[model samples]
Target: MASFEASVQLNATPQEMFDFLIDTENILKISPPDTGLSFTKKPDKLYKGAILEFQIQGFGKVQEGTHEIIVFEEPTLFTEKQISGPLKSYTHEHHIVPAGENQITLIDRLEFEPPGGLLGFLITESKLLDLFDEGFYQRHQTLKKLFP
Candidate 1:
């Protein structure tokens, strides 16, 4: 298993930060448009057991997958597990912690294990890790711009 984590502090209230982070619409806007993500199921309110399906377009093909909310805590933490996807297993956990009265920090932790153990290690060491690093950095920048 390989782990990738990124954290960013924002000058916003925890509630405010949570609102933006939990919103799927905001995610789609900040995500690369070329990814072609479409939510199959969206909830009016966020909680445990929420399900969502996304289609990612890459290399001239669309890969479809669904994620299930495995852990949820209001205004603090939320986690989702990839139920079906290209990877063997994937889980993304989001954490929001209050820094001060009007400041908050967002933490994103992604733990994934791909198929073909040896091959997976090679892939992560080669380009996939860099790709994830860049993606998270861009996401943090986008959040900073959006929140700060």
Candidate 2:
């Protein structure tokens, strides 16, 4: 069980932030440039029951993942659970909170278990956290550019 959380204040309304998140095309814009995150199968907008198939080839590694949208709340929250991926289990929640009259707070939460049961040495929790830190920093920069 490992977890990562990050929150960024954006100069946009909750609906605005939510709209950006639900758009599949915006993903590549916010993701780390070298991650090469792309969808093999996707929908224009995200909603409960929507499934996503994606692949990333970067950091000197390549991997594929599939996730199911388990929860969707317009202008507020969206959650996805990994159906299959590098990790044994993975869940991500996107929370959009009203920050001010014309602003919103975007929060990202992730919980997962690295591959392997007792011998998950290939990917460590610390390493994952570091990766998340770097990824979110880049994401935040992009969000700021897009929203501000």
Candidate 3:
């Protein structure tokens, strides 16, 4: 499986960061505008066992994916696993840690197996990182401004 991890310091409390993350509508704000992200299953807040179904426009086609919240610890961490998607498997963990009096650190970890079977070997970790780096950069930038 390929893995990715990234963290950012946000000038907000853990509860604040966690609250922002649990809201499904915020996805459109952080993602690249061209992605055309829209939720098929919209919830005011996420909870354990909640399923997230959405479609994203990419390469002139629409791709749909579904993720289930496997773990949920309020204002601390949560893990989402892809039950159906383009990839063979995908798991994402979001962690929130108190950094200072009013600051928090948000970390994201992802482990995924590419869409192919043995052919997945062609996709290197670095390549996967490069693919996600752009989106995450935009995401982090938006977070910084949101909490500033």
Ranking by lDDT: 2, 3, 1
Candidate 1, residues 65-118, lDDT tens digits: the string is: 888888878778899999997677889998999988788888989888765566
Clashing pairs in 2: none
Candidate 1: the clashing residue pairs are none
lDDT of each: 0.78, 0.89, 0.85
Displacement of residue 5 (Cα, Å) in model 2 is 0.5
Q: Could you give candidate 3's per-residue lDDT for residues 14-120 as a string of tens digits?
A: 99888889988876778877777888885778999999999987445787999999999998999999989767888999999999999998998999877676545
Name the 10 consecutive residues with the lowest summed lDDT in model 1.
119-128
Between candidates 1 and 2, the lDDT winner:
2
Where model 3 places Cα greater than 4 Å from the true spot, the runs are 117-126
Clash pairs detected, candidate 3? none
Q: Of 1 and 3, which scores higher on lDDT?
A: 3
TM-scores of the candidates are 0.86, 0.95, 0.90
Off-target runs (Cα >4 Å) in candidate 2 are: 117-119
Question: Residue 3's C-alpha lDDT in candidate 1?
Answer: 83
